[model samples]
Target: MIHDVAIVGAGMAGASLAAAIGPRARVLLLEAEDMPGRHATGRSAAFWSETYGGPAVQPLTTASGPALRDGGYLTPLGSLHVGRAEDDARIERLLADFAGSGVELSRVDPAAHIPGLRPEWVRGVREPSCAYIDVAALHADYLAAAKAAGAEIRTDAAVTGAGRRDGVWHLETRAGLFSARLLVDAAGAWADEVAKLAGVAPIGITPYRRTMVQLRTDPPAPEGLPHVVDIAGNFYFKPEAGGRLWLTPHDESPSAACDIAPEEWDVAVAIDRLEKVVDWRVEAVERRWAGLRSFAPDRAPVYGFDPKTPGFFWCAGQGGFGIQTAPAASAMAAALLLGEGGVPEGLDAERYGAGRFPAMR
Candidate 1:
């Protein structure tokens, strides 16, 4: 059977976009793993921060807030961007950057917000708009929405080959053969490979590994501990359940597309950074893991169709902000994929268009 759209990788991007496009078209979601979101989506820090992907991505995140809150998928969990006296200029610049971007940010005392903060870390900015996302529930809801719309979901379907013949995408997957009018490359880290298989030029989407370490600290983390990020981009930590802290060195190690393990050096760097940030003692390293964040050379999400490849859509390069921006991003992607109506007002679709890439241009 030929589907109107067949999305590669059933992660957040693909699933949410499928749900957005399902009602109007016959959609098929193809997953390589036994389940969807087994990678980045599942391993996400699970917080929605407007400042996360920089000013360029703030619009999308801000626009998604209302829907997430309405769906009851967002819980009130604020964020704190902290720094030392030397980082005052950078901290001020942060507020200046998003001055009129609709994101609510205010300066505050770091020590008052983050308990046990070292004296050196004196500056703080509160982004009250930030919150925790129920990732698992959000993903499940999108899948359910797509399913309810009659979109077919196929797991364990690793695509081996892909080609367009007579305007239909003929795909060879581990699960079986499939045909679709429009093929979407949402394979996360493997997006380029999927494009190549479909006879499209590679867009230089590089995959980078990020590490996360869960620590059981001497002073159990306070329940209200905000997601604390460093102004220097060194590290960030937030309180997890049971008085545990989830920390990351903010390391972005260039890596190949595959299941990744946390590098011991990264874990050590995280611990060292954490110790300097707070006075709490880390009693145990409860858990450590890593996930790949793929990005286009420009670091902006790539949406819309390929310039030279017909019936092929590019829906990868989300990096770490995919889930937070999913609600709006998927809607934007759906508008483009469908070729009619439903475009979110004020969003510059051309900025995220696939044609923006230098290679394509």
Candidate 2:
């Protein structure tokens, strides 16, 4: 049997796309793991920060806010961007850049936002619009909705090869052979590899490893602490349940496509940075994990049909904003894929298309 579209991953990107397009097309959601969201989606400590993805990505993320908020997938955690006095210019530029972007922003004393804030952290920018994302619930909901819409999801279906034959995408997967009219490269970190398997030119999408550690602090993190991020891009941390703090060094080490392990050095760096930022004492490192955030050469998510290869579509290179941008990204991708002209408002749909990458040609 032939499906209308075959999505190569079952993570947030693929799942969201499936959820959006499943009603309009027969979708086959494929995952190499025994279950969906075993990679980045499963490990995301995501927050819908309007400034997190920079200017190009903020549109999609901002556009997604309504759906995520309406679905009750977001909680008002707020965001604090802290920096040294010397970094005032950067902070001002940030405030200026997003002045009227619909993302509420204001300057506040670091001490007010973070308990026991360091003296050097003199500059602070508060974004009240940012909120923590319920990633697990969103992923599950997307998969469930997709399935309910008649999309077939097959776990452990790693595609070994793909080729176009007789106007159909023939795929050889571990589960079995499958055919579809269009193939979406949503394999996350393995997207470039999947493109190669389909005899299409690789788009140079690279996966970077990011580490997160859960710390049981001596004083126990405050329940009302906002998600704190360093303006210099050194670290970020937010309070978790059970008096734990989820922390990251904001390290983006280059890595290949695979199950990633957190390096001890990275964990140490996170602790070191946290120590300088706040007065919280780490009684124990309750847990630590790492995941890959893939990106294209331009660092924007690639969408739209491939210019070089027909029947091949791109929904990859989401980097770290995949979950936060899923709602609108999926809507935009589905509209483009379905030949519908109704793209989401305020989303610069052309910037994310595959045609922008001359390297892929």
Candidate 3:
């Protein structure tokens, strides 16, 4: 049977888009794993900060804020970007770049907020709107809503090959063959491979590994401590429950598209960086993990259809901001796919359009 649209990944990107499409179209979500969201979505150190994804992505993040807040998936966890005196220029540039972008940023003394902060880390910029996200709950809700809205989901359906004939896509998956009028590639790290299998030009969507570690610290991470990030983009950490701290070195190691694991070198680097930023003693390395973040050549999300391939749509390359921007991105992608709704207001549709990529054009 032919589905109206078949998305090749049931992670946040695919699930949210499926939910947004609702019953307006017959949608099918194909998962490569035993269940959905086994990769990036499930492993995200989830946070929703308007400035987290840079200026190009700020609009979508801002637009998605309301939906997440209304759904009770967000809790206050302000972000503090701190740095040494020499990094003040980065702070000013950040404020200048996003001056009119609706992301709130203000100067603050680093020591006033992050206890035991090194004195050399003098300048700081605070983004009070940043908050933690309930990623698991959000992903699960999208999947459930999509299912309830009449969209079908099949797990262990890895697309081994894809071909288009007579204006219809025929996908051969591990589970079985499926036919769809329109094929959507929300395959996360495997997006480019899926495009290639469909005889479409690959968009250079590269996956990068990011490392995270939870530590038991001495003098314990203080209660109500803001998420502290370095202005140089080297590290970020925040207080977790039981007086522990969740930290990452902001490592973006280029990697293959597969199940990933944290490297000891990266973990050591995180600890080294954390030591320089604060006086906290590392009592134990409680937990460590890694996840993949895929990006297009330009880093902004890719939406819209292939310029040269009919019935083929591109909805991958969301990178690390996929969760925070899911609501807006999915809504916009759904509107583009089904032509059933208007693009979210103030969204720079062209920036996110597939046509923007020279390869797609």
> Which 10-residue window in model 1 sums to the lowest lDDT?
340-349
**Cα RMSD to native, each candidate?**
0.9, 0.9, 0.8
Candidate 3 CA-lDDT value: 0.93
lDDT of 3 by residue, 1-361 (tens): 7899999999999999999996798998999999999999999988888988799899999999999999999999999999898997898888998998878899999799988988899999999999999999999999999999999999999999999999889999999999999999999999999999999999999999999999999989999899888889999998888998999999999999999999999999999999998888999999999999999999999998989999899999999999999999999999899977699998977789888877678
Writing each residue's lDDT as its tens digit, candidate 1 over 1-361 gives: 8999999999999999999999999999999999999999999988999999888788888889889999999988899999999998999899999999888899899899877889988899999878889999999999999999999999999999998889899999999999999999999999999998888999999999999999999888987999999999999888888888889999999998998889899999999999999999989999999999999998888999999999999999999999999999999999999998687877888989889877886
Q: What TM-score should be assigned to candidate 2? A: 0.98
Q: Which segments of model 1 are wrong by more than 4 Å?
A: none
- RMSD (CA, Å), candidate 3 to true, equals 0.8
Clash list (residue pairs), candidate 3: none
Candidate 3 Cα misplacement greater than 4 A, ranges: none
Tell me the deviation in Å of residue 300 in model 1: 1.1
Candidate 1 TM-score over all chains jointly = 0.98
The runs of at least 3 residues in candidate 2 whose Cα sits more than 4 Å from the true structure, single-residue gaps closed, are: none
Cα RMSD of predicted structure 2 = 0.9
